[model samples]
Target: MVRASAGRIWSVSSNPCQDQIHYAQLNWDEDGQPLSSVFGDVYFSRVNGLEETRHVFLQHNQLAQRWEALPEKVHFVIAETGFGSGLNFLAAWELWLTTAPRSAQLHFVSVEKFPLDKNDLIRALALWPELEFLSQQLIDAYPCIVGEGFHRLSFMDGRIKLTLIINDAARGFSKLLTTTDPLYSQYSAKVDAWFLDGFAPSKNPQMWSEDLFSCIHQLSNAGTSAATFSAAAIVKKGLKFAGFAIEKVTGFGRKREMLKAIMPNNSQDYFYPQPAYKSASTFPSSWSINTNLDIYPDKHALIIGAGLAGCSSARALAERGWKVTLLERNNAIASEASGNPQGVLYAKLSYKEEAQAEFNLTSLQFAQSFYSSHWANIGKKTGVLQLAHCDSEQVLQTQLQEKFAAADELVQFVSCTKASEIAGVPLSFNAIYFPNAGWINPAKLCEQLVSHPLINVVTGIAAFNIQRTEHGWCINNDRELQAPVVIIANARDAQHFEQTQHLPIKSIRGQVTYLPATIASKEIKTVICSEGYIAPASAGIHCTGATFNLKEESKELRVEDHQTNLENLREPLQELLAEWENSDKHSLDGRVAFRCTLPDYLPAVGPVADEPAMLHSFASLRKNARAFIQDTGKYLPGLYLNIGHGSRGLAYTPLCAEILAAHINNEPQPIARDLVNALNPARFLIRDLIKNKR
Candidate 1:
């Protein structure tokens, strides 16, 4: 949905050459209504409605005294003309989880036409159970599309992002990406608060005409405020002829006057700039774009471990130009199990349709876009749920909810009363939820993924020393250097390199059983999962551990691994731990480490070659390996490895660092190069040089 053409600025009546472009395109009429307009005894809704909208637009748009006087993480962005049944987005997500504050961020935006149906939004959000779990995460992200629509429900990930604009608020505020100036703009950030509630002016008079206040005064910018439950008189003469200053207020809960206005500060010098993003200046701070310029346009790289997968792959390859030195024999950086404090985006969903259900659905959508803005710097969103244990994992969560209907925010399945209202507990099992999943903090996302800018981490410097050199591979992480490429992302201390100790790696030795928080585990705020996994309290305990063992590899620390993580959290919160073993205030805070794996558990990743030149370069198909061939260097040339992402390193380490930087930037590898040579580490010396020539 990325098309628009009213007075074309970016025309496209139709073109589905999509691979990625969904800015949610739209257009609907023929009785699907939504031409919209209204003012003078309020009415609005050319579709959008959540109760003649919160006492006519957020109680006279003062929004709880403009969020108890702003200042912290400042963000407000609310503009609207319609976005039906989102009940003003579940009443501004229950007023930003009850009265903003806590580093604010909202960005609402609206405008829509003919869009509803997911059982007419589950019969109009079954009369809002007081926004019960955000109206069941907007009925599990509405959008079924029988026709016209534009959607973007990011709820609670960037702290509520919304952005629907289905079409026509005078062509979606003239294709926003604003720079401000349309009509003495400035409600705050060029167009802050202004729902204006459309639907009247005589059943939609081209939405209060005069070209809708000349497209909101050419996309405004000048101390704006424009409100309207409607105080008639040609809608205050089209908002005082689109420059704003009108005021009338007093209509909410009992209508008796309401117009509120103010656009003063009109030193209108027209401005709107803000969206050029592409700066990480060898990475250090500020980022929103330059996401390592299309992800590290290689200026140089060679990361290979400083722990936490070489300090998060040397800050995702020196924020994309790879100068990282990390290496490490252990001097600090998450001394393993990524120095846990929290780590549960655990997506193991395959209640039927499998391929590890598209590899745990593209590693939980790149771990929710790599931990979407770090759960407010450490962790929170508190929703992972999962539950269901028997009856074949409740019919594999209904065949992974129809094979992840294009990732309906990671996954759904609920009911044990909407999974006890999103895992607040009280379940008869059966759950799935994953509403953008949560529980992060892994040493503050591994020190914010190796705080970038061509990283040089160093640590206990342990490469020891290597050879092969004509211009690459010199080695000596303790001092010497040179490279063509090198990466191991150490874990199970990469089998002390005798050419990676015949890697078919195995280590397990885990242990987690923390439990402090009470009052029924502090009302469980999501992230529960069955057989193992508990988290939701984080850094204040609650972390219900891991206990794999593989015959123990000890870094010390156990109690039979906290009785195998309280017997795997007694299978799905066993009746919410019926006062968990007669509470003496349950204890045990396990963690042991050693987890690297493989035995077809995938992720060994490319080029660390020359084990009998990949056993005679795949010796006529490992006696049984001819699937397809042509890659004849069988690479060992400059060495590489990302490690068998066993216990799904937070769902496969940033998608195996975008598949080992797209096989070191030859690009295109999103899966398939024979699943990237089935995670190549030279398929066990091409199956022992094709079983000694058969």
Candidate 2:
């Protein structure tokens, strides 16, 4: 670990991606304090960890005072270095809950290279019985695999949000600081307080490197305060050089002294001036405006459609202090595309590392973890087995396993014999088993999402006539409703809006047949998918097929669709198909639904553009594709869209909703830059312009 010089940018170290996490080797000292064998340092004060955390972190930072004085609906952010046993985080959360206004939110961001496993966390948290209530929630929501990425966990009905980045301190802080994604813009890479809780400078010197301090300085606002148990010369010098005014403080228990520091009020000198967004030369144009401008107003949003997209979007925005009004034409939520009894959490992965495949993999993992926390009993963790039906599919599966470097937790290739044993059924072919994949009840998930206190769902009202008013956009019908921001999330019906009519959204009709689970068929444990899929028994029946038809519109259950389902089931459940074929046609039950999709099959998320205005502005892109234009594009101010998820609604909608929330809040996005562009609703127009097809 090299030290960073003042006025010199420190380069981030290479990722420790493949390195196994070094768990803390705990040893009890004579005084009964937990000691780390690797670092040879105490985990906390020998006298008391809880009191030390409150004094060294909370008192020095004045968290309780700051939290009490916070403005309404504001989010107070605290970033910590080493969240060993999360003592600091727990103390802060408890203080915030007691001191802050009910409407204010607390966002605690922590970086940990080596997180304790569930059992370890439980054991360690047991030391603080007073914090048992909060610790239990964290334990329940903790990531099982602890994969490399940001894991966001919300508690207290979304009032408290914890974003745990499991990575090296320097690497995580650097990645976070460099992100231009809108989801993180809310804080501008600044935090209110810092908990420099790594082991003592002598014991774990690597964690207190100058690079780490420099990164911390970069993420701190002018008034950021930090406290640490170490008052070593290097610790003090690094923080002082990085722009914080430091002082030695009285230490807890037997410790001689600790350090406390605060960035000066005028300490903007640490950061370079933010440069403008680099407009893509081939990107579409619209009414010229600043690309970095945020358009959200008054923290209120009106969302059309109450299905998965709408409800998820509503929940995301509501968590961010936005009051959302969700409108559905049907008398109840999820009465359309999201009304399926069981939706499989399928990834639909590809061999090619394209945007779709990458997005699917990440979204699958996020949704699986997210559903386990939010949708608990409504979903099953029975892994999904995707069999290779053709030569091309077999090649793709092989590539996915070998070339793409898929992890066993995410997916693994299995032979016919292995697949049969895993599924508890006689299988025909080899498969890719997604261990994290499962099945969810779409309607139930939607119901849970809209139940948030910040979301006001109004069903049985069709918002047909919409007009841009001086106040905001107003929806007119028997009743008039208005909000500063509006989101179209009604799947295919989004096209009913004049602004969205130009969108190439196609509604594909589909039907899923349900077969009564027999003693033999009930043995089918995992969801088996080839051309079609069959979920494990739910309510004494298994959901199967989903005959896709582009032209069909009628919702009536067709006898032929059931036959098609039976035929599709023969390959996977050979014996069960014979029994089902012999049953009465009327006994065959199923659900008919429409899946909204785009020409390119990606969901239309993010901001909506003024299509005609953009076309007129960037029409020349058709002639000169390489021309660099200053204008990115013009989005209808405060207007956004989250639709066209197709059949992977369960897998895609949650992440898409998060993306929409990020755009609305002008925060950093969770996904990469290119992937964010792929979900842009204006991409179709940009493609048409580049192809000279306007």
Candidate 3:
């Protein structure tokens, strides 16, 4: 086996219509009906297949039996290949979640090359109404990972993780074998049961080859067990060759035979004890449940301001077994600059294949899916349109359209007439219409975010000092509150702490105007962004303005910013307002707040600590990084953060919270692992001091 950890590989271009290729392409005959491969393997060979899965995979895998058998709580790992349509995975997951004991954790590891787009996935899974919610979750988080990387998604807090390896079987299993590269390898997975569900060997030769069987052999333990609908003799021979003693059984559907295999030998001889995942120590617990599990999870996540960053972080942590304590010093959330009645969910694109624009586009899509799935109760799918005012804008849009070459349904070139019609307001220039974009109630969203059961929200609490403790950290307010983890999400107040005093967090104050939606306003159905934004009337309030005044950090409404917004939302709105001849400027209500923004725009997450350690560790970065300890060890111990959401908070928070949780849970991250390290709080310390010769 060519074994040294391989270097980076070039990415295969994905099908423009979907994130990856379509699995159906391999399963269907020319008529697109269920046809076997040349070897005659049906995609789903089980009749009442769903029931058969529950009975065999679930019951035999001893799911209900296992749960009932548990003397103490533990986690179960069920791995699979070819997660086509996710029916089997979802059904199994539903059983685990609903029927399994609350204390039990289920890890469903599956590999998939082709993943369906959301609309189609949602449509396909509609058949299984019982698994609707679970399916929606899988579909929503269906990673758009293009190349070969493990896209780990969290479900049921940190308990269930979908370790979606988005590559061919041979490569994915090879990487899995090396997961314990001798570090942080505790709990490196060995499948308890493998659900083999790839297309027939004849149809997809690469998937069912000897190399694939070799991977299974190298990756699994001697006791590892697997099941498949295929009873083909070649399959039996391959399993036997791979060291798995195979046996034919009653098959599903019209098939009279199926196969199950088990490697009945001691695997512990090859197994190296993994210590990284196993905590070096455990906390003293008053009860058994608390002793074995993270019952006293780190709580008291502080969000100083009720703006996007704080609220979003608070919401994410709160949902995932963390006790979020949001401290807004103010009387209400989003009273600050994020108090806008409506904020546009716009995706910026560049003509020159810009990095920033690409990031924004992906962020926009992730954000939309995040909200649509997580916060659908409060979200509106009005979509956002970026107006192209001039020839330069048009040129950039056209070039970007070609460079992206993604699903055309994502973004479309709308002429003035169509743009005007879609906007529900008249338009003067052509624009790019993002059909999935819309505006959100920032404050309402915050309220929703902090409303989780695990979250204990206290407003009007002014934090004076934050000091670390043996148990956790202390919040110096009325008396003192203890928490294992603390997040300084209080915008400008975050700077008051000694650990973060060097951070470049600043407050930007702004004001927004709220007007009544007229029949003329009905024309502005979608969010329209130029210099400023105008959103469709929500709850009878037509939101406009949002003039950015960097110097004014006060919460008082200013006419200048309003006038600035008026000009920014120009074109049709300008004419409509002037034509109304309504000299009354007070026809709109105004509000203001401070926006805590970082200089470089990226957030300060993970840990906070002395910068000197960071600088010293990464000191050799200016020269050859490999010559020294280039990556700074995580700065703070037991202390981490999730802040600096900025204006992109709506677009960034869901993933940001995910990053924070993954770090704390030691699970795979939602963002690129490199990006996670890049966003580390100690990153700037290393860059400015260690990597900088100047």
Best by lDDT: 2
The collision pairs in model 3 are 304-490, 336-593, 337-593, 383-437, 384-437, 423-525, 424-523, 424-524, 425-523
Q: What's each prediction's TM-score?
A: 0.30, 0.81, 0.75
Over the stretch 234-335, how does candidate 1's per-residue lDDT look in tens digits? 889887777778878666544578797766665354222322222212221110000111222224455656545556555544443457666666787777
For candidate 3, lDDT tens digit of each residue in 1-694? 1111112222334445424333332234332323322335544533555776665466544566655654323456667777766777887777776566665556676777654445445655675677787887787677554344455566765456677766666655555542313222222235666777777655666677777776566556666777877777667877776678677777665757778888768533333344532343231210100001132343455555566667777766665556677777777877765667777776565543233443455566556656764446565778777888757777777766544444444577878899888887678888888786678777778777777787767778777777777776777833346676677766666778777877767677767787676667756678887667778888877677676667665666666666676777666456666632354565557777666666666667665655565555555666653342312253555566666666666776666666666555443344443355446665555555534642
Q: Pick the TM-score winner.
A: 2
* Span of ten consecutive residues with least summed lDDT in model 2: 2-11
Ranking by TM-score: 2, 3, 1
Provide the clash count, candidate 1: 35
lDDT of each: 0.59, 0.77, 0.61
Q: Please give the range of 10 consecutive residues that has the lowest summed lDDT in model 3.
A: 284-293
lDDT of 2 by residue, 196-300 (tens): 888787877877887787777777767888888878998898888778999898988887898899999766553433343343322333322215445454889
TM-score of 2: 0.81
Q: At residue 523, what lDDT does model 2 achieve?
A: 91
